[model samples]
Structures are given as C-alpha cells and as structure tokens.
Target: MKILPFVALTATLFSSGAAFATEQTVTLNVANATCELCGPIVKGSLSKVSGVLDVQISEADGAAIAKVRFEDSRTNVPALITATTNAGYPSRIVQ
Candidate 1:
C-alpha cells in the first residue's frame, strides 16, 4: 500500500528525466579530410563521444561533412567539434 505509492512516485520522477533528454542533429564542416582515410578517422573520433547516437561522415569534393545525432543532455556541438579537432580535423557546425 504505502510501498506502492512510493514506487509509483520514484518511477514518475525517473521517467520525467527521460522527457527532458532531447535528441539533436547537426551537420559539421570538417577541414583536412583530403584522403579516404580521413572519413574513418573523423567517424571514429565522433563515435567515442558520450551521447553520440550516430555519425555519418562523407569526404567528397575534397570536403568532409559529418552529420551527427546526439542527446543534448550528454553532449553538444562544441564537444563534437573538440572530438574531431583533437583528432587533427578541425570542424565547425554548419549553419
């Protein structure tokens, strides 16, 4: 009886946190992906970031474009930039 009410309240509280977690997708322009190897390197870097759900990197016409989906509560655009930049590929969010 009393325990049931407590369990319900706890479940509601935990579930509410899930409601606040938002998924965001962003496209980034990455520099220095001049070869076929660059795409894999960039993808590997972004994939290691926390909360990164998906990463698609394309190296075409000497440009690298990465489309990423992530949970905003655990990561953001800046973190994504840092991950790629640290891997020797500087990147910025495409407006």
Candidate 2:
C-alpha cells in the first residue's frame, strides 16, 4: 500500500541519518614539547587515536600547538588530551 511505502521511506531516512559522522577540529596547547623532536611525538600521539583524522603541530612561546581534526562521534577532547598525556606530552584545549 502507499501508506506502507511512505512509512518505510520515513524510517529509512531517519535510520540513515545516524550514519553521518560529525567532525570537529580543536587546538590543543601542548606542554613539554621543548625539543624539535617533540612535534613528531605529539603528532604521532594524536594520530594514534581511533577517530583522529589529521594532526598538525607547531610551536609558539616554547610550547606546541596541535591542531587536530577528528570524528566527534568516535572521539572527543578528553580522549585527545589523554592521548598526548599518555605519550609523555601534557596538553590542554586552547579555549
């Protein structure tokens, strides 16, 4: 019946909506990235996270700034921070 088809269509639309991933980017101020070698280490740490898409590292004021892009549904700020901390670099959200 026409009503049954419409119901099926509506259900399909709603169900598929959940499959879309929400992406987010955050800048973290990383501490203990004093040496030049620290950039690669921080980048590697962030990259190891499951949902992290990309990571770029730069230095400012003797600390490292990590710009990270990740899938929000798969990970979050806390996970990112933990990744860096576990890698021996402590970090905080840049605001």
Task: Report the lDDT tens digits of candidate 2 across residue range 3-91.
Answer: 99999988997786546778899999999999999999999999999989999999998799999999987889999999999999999
- Name every residue pair that clashes in candidate 2: none
Cα lDDT computed for each candidate against the true fold: 0.93, 0.93
lDDT of 1: 0.93
Q: Give the TM-score of candidate 1.
A: 0.84
Model 1 steric clash pairs: none
Angstrom error of the Cα, residue 11, model 2: value is 7.9
Instruction: List, residue by residue over 15-41, the lDDT tens digit for candidate 1.
Output: 767658999999999998999899999
- The local lDDT score (0 to 100) that residue 94 gets in candidate 2 is 95
Candidate number of the best TM-score: 1
| Model 2 clashing-pair count | 0
